[model samples]
Target: MDLLNNLALGFGVAFTFQNLMYALIGCLFGTLVGVLPGLGPLATIAMLLPITYGLPPVAALIMLAGIYYGAQYGGSTTAILVNLPGESSSVVTVIDGYQMARKGRAGPALAAAGMGSFFAGCVGTLILAAFAAPLTELALEFGPAEYFSLMIVGLIGAVVLASGSLLKALAMIVLGLLLGLVGTDVNSGVARYSFDIPELTDGISFVAIAMGIFGYGEIISNLSQSDENREVFTDKVKGIMPTATDLKRMFPAVLRGTALGSALGILPGGGALLSAFAAYTIEKKTKLKPGEVPFGQGNIRGVAAPEAANNAGAQTSFIPLLTLGIPPNAVMALMVGAMTIHNIQPGPQVMTSNPELFWGLIASMWIGNAMLIILNLPLIGIWIKLLTVPYKWLFPAIVLFCAIGVYSTNNNSFDIWVVALFGLIGYGFIKLGCEPAPLLLGLILGPMMEEYLRRALLISRGDWSVFVTRPISAGLLVVAAILLTIVLLPSVKKKREEAFVED
Candidate 1:
């Protein structure tokens, strides 16, 4: 009864005219970015973070959530129509989706992706709704020591699950922690790393770092690529709906994918991209029917499964951020920045303190998923047309927008320089084979961790054993240690590398 009442309240908030409009706008922009190969939701959201300052918190969150999942819907369009994946999570889709386009079965391939995504997205949201309250109750029981230990678990999970070299990821996390210490020390009010620069007193702007690394950095990289490499198959889209046979094949794959995605999405560092890869692997291992296509040769299941998984993963990744104030990925870290900007502290308190924002955001996701379906299907032609725009023109606009967005955050010219500096650093990270996601997680969590550590020590009178003395905190640290041990095993390390290989 309480669940129903909460949902009803959520719907009431989401149904307002202003909230509905923002949701539509977010879905539209999300689809646009998803159709464009190099522009991802992380970068786009970073660029728009400052703009959310003027919006009502509910509308702002609704829009941002829409963009996050709506990208899953649009990414499949590019993967199927062209050989390019608009989002990293869509990389596997290209293998079979492009083949389907070549075989003139693009219609059924697209239909399967769209239908699967919609179903999975809805299921993921339902899980989020059901799980959020209980998780919040659990979170409310945590003290400073428990929170600190939990963050340790989250960070270790990121390192274990992050793709690529463990050493590089560790280095990135350390660097981010050092960067987070740049501002004045809250304990003594003494400037530590400012070096006499007035701008460094407040520490680096999260917006600047996000835009530089994700937005401008990506644009700079995209500019270096030759324009001749892109290939579009816009003319091949003939039919709009899948046949009854195609639907029959797609249903089971979608169900399996949604289940896998919903579960994986809750883990730190395992979101849409990991979910898509895992789902594709599961589908490949499953035996084919008597006359159906093989695994990579335009199999409808291939398209359906990954698309469903990615969408489902994208939706459920919000759980940790909302319930525990821990961001599971780079995108969620940006969301942390967004919530902070609006003066809303994310965590268990948000449920008790701001039920409207919490439930409204959840309810809006259902509306957003529906909006994505309506936007993606009949409007497929528009997205394809958008792809035809030359990169040369697009890159300049992106660069300009990033500059403006960063500057607006502080209305200071120094931020523009800071963004430029970080942009170069971001490119360097790419060149050095480092994943920037862990760095982002560390940056967002560092200050929070420090605060929690201090509080625990103060409460325990500097005993340092309080973390282990508390059952919850001790358990969390044990989990982190176990995860680290498992990831460090030679066999698991090699398998981790193999799992990340897109080919």
Candidate 2:
């Protein structure tokens, strides 16, 4: 009964004229960027973060959330049509989806993906709404020691789940923590690493770092490659609806994917990419029906399962951010930046403190999912036409937008220079095969972790045993330790590397 009343309040807020418009706009922009092979949700969201400064917090969060999941819908379009994945999560789709397109079954494949995504997104949001309240209730019991121990678990989970060298991810996290220490100490009047630079006193701008690393850095990487490498799909797509038989087969796959993805998304570092990869793997290993297509040759189950998983993962990734104030992935970390900008502290208290914003954001996700399906199907041609734009022209506009956005944050020219410097650093990370997502997590969580750790020790009169003395804190530390041990084992390390390899 309380859930019904809360959802009713949410719908009342989301149905307002202004919120609906922003939701539509966000869905459109997300699809546009998703269809363009090189532009991804991370870069798109980072570039657009500045524009949300003037929006009401509820509206801003709603739109950004729309963009994140809308990309899941649009990414499969390019992957199916041109065999080019618009985002990392869509990479598995290209295997069977593109094969379906080649055989003139693109319509069924795309329809299965779009419809499956819609269903999964709704289920994921419902799960989030049901579980978030209980999770928040549990989080309210945590003290400073427990909070700090939880962060350690989160950081280790990131390294364990990252699809790269564990050592590289650890190095990135350490770098981020060091960078996060560049501001004035809250406990004392002394500056730490400011080097007498006025701009450094507040530490590096979050917007500057996000835009530099994700926005401008991506632009540079995209332009370095020749345009000749891209393959455009200009074929006419016929019959956008799936047959009854196809729907029957796709329904079960969607259910399985939604279940898997919902569970994974709540875990640290398990977002759309990991969910999609796992879904496809599970589908391939399952028994096939008589007369069904083989695993790799245009299987409808392949398209449906991953699309459902990725969309579901994208939605449920909000659980950690909303409940515990921990960001499970980079996109959610950016959401933390967004929340801070609006002067809202994201944590267990948000539900009690700001019911409208919390519930309205949840409701808006359902609206956004509906908008995506309508926009993705009929407007597919328009998105395909957008792909015709040359990269040379597109990148210059992106660079200019990023510069203007970064400068607007503080209206200071120094921020622009800061972006430029970090852009170079981001390129270095890319060249060195280091994933920057973990770094963003570290940057966002580092200060909070330190604050909690100091508070705990201060309460314990500098006793180091306080962390283990608390049962909840000790359990979290044990989990972190076990994760680190698993990641370091030789057999597990080799298998982790193998799992990340593209088929």
Candidate 3:
């Protein structure tokens, strides 16, 4: 009954005229960018973070959440139509989706992707609604030591789950922790690494870091690619509906993908990209029905499964951010920045203190999913038309918006320079084969970890054994250690590399 009441309250908040309008706008813009190659939700959200300052918190979060999952819906369109993945999570969709397009079954392929994504998105949101309150209750029991230990688990999970070299991920995390320390100390009010620069005193604007590393960095990289690499299929799309036979084949795949994605999405560093890959791999291993298409050669299941998984993953990845004040991925890290901007501290307290924002954001997701399905199918022609815009024109606009967004955060010009510096550094990270997601996670978690560690020690009078003395903290540390050990095993490392080989 309480759950029903909370949901009713959520709907009341979400159905407001202003909130509904922003949700529509977010879904529309998310699809537009998703249709265009190179631009992704991460960069787009980073660019828009500052703009959320003027919005009511619930409305702002609703819109941002819409953009994140809506991108999943739009990305499959490009993967099927252009043989290009508009979002990294859509990479697997290109294999069978483009083949379906090539075989003139593009309509069925697209319909499957859309239907799968919509179903999975709804299921994921349902899981979030059911589990979020319980998780918040669990989190409320945590003290400083337990919280610190939980962060350790979260960081280690990121390293274990992150693709590529373990050492590189660790190095990036350390670098981010160091960067996060540049601001004044909260306890002492003494500057640590400011070097007397007025701007450095407040530390680096995470908005600047996010925009530079994701927004500007991606634009700069996209600009370097030659025009020949960006060929679009321009073929006209006709039927948008899947046949009854196609629906039968798609239903099971969508179910499996949604389950896998919902579970994986809760793990740190396991987001839409991993969920899609895992779902595709599972579909490949499943035996095909008599007379059905093979794994990669225009298999409708291939399109349906990954699309469902990505969307599901995108929605469920919010679990940690909302429940524990921990961001599970780069995109969630940006969300942390957004929440902080609005003076809302994410975690258990949010549910107790700001039920409207919390439940309203959850309820708006269902509305957003419905909006995406409506927008994606009928507006396919419009999205395809948007693909025709040249990158040459798009890149400058993106760079300009990024600069403006960063500057507006503090109304300071120094942030523009900060963004430029990190833009180069971001490009350098790209060149160096280092992933920046872990770095962003570390930056976001560093200060919180420090505060927790200090509080724990202060409470124990500098006793180093406090973390292990508490049952909850001890369990968390043990989990982190076990995860690190398992990831370090040679056999698991080999398989891990193979899983992310698509990158």
Over 126-241, each residue of candidate 1 has an lDDT whose tens digit, in order, gives 99999999999999999999999999988888788777899998888888788889998989899879999999999988889988987777667767777776777678778979
Over 4 Å off, model 2 = none
Global lDDT of each candidate: 0.86, 0.85, 0.86
Summarize candidate 3's per-residue lDDT along 343-441 as a digit string, tens digits. Answer: 999899999999999999999999999998887888877777777788888778778878887888899999999899898888888788887888888
Q: What is the per-residue lDDT of model 2 for residues 313-401, given as tens digits with 9 covering 90 to 100?
A: 88899998999999988888889999999999989999999999999999999999999988888887677677678878777777898
* TM-score-superior candidate, 2 or 3: 3
For candidate 1, the 10 contiguous residues with the lowest summed lDDT are: 32-41
- Model 1 segments more than 4 A misplaced: none
Please give the distance, in angstroms, between residue 432's alpha carbon in candidate 3 and its true position after superposition. 2.9
Clashes (backbone N, CA, C under 3 Å), per candidate, total 0, 0, 0
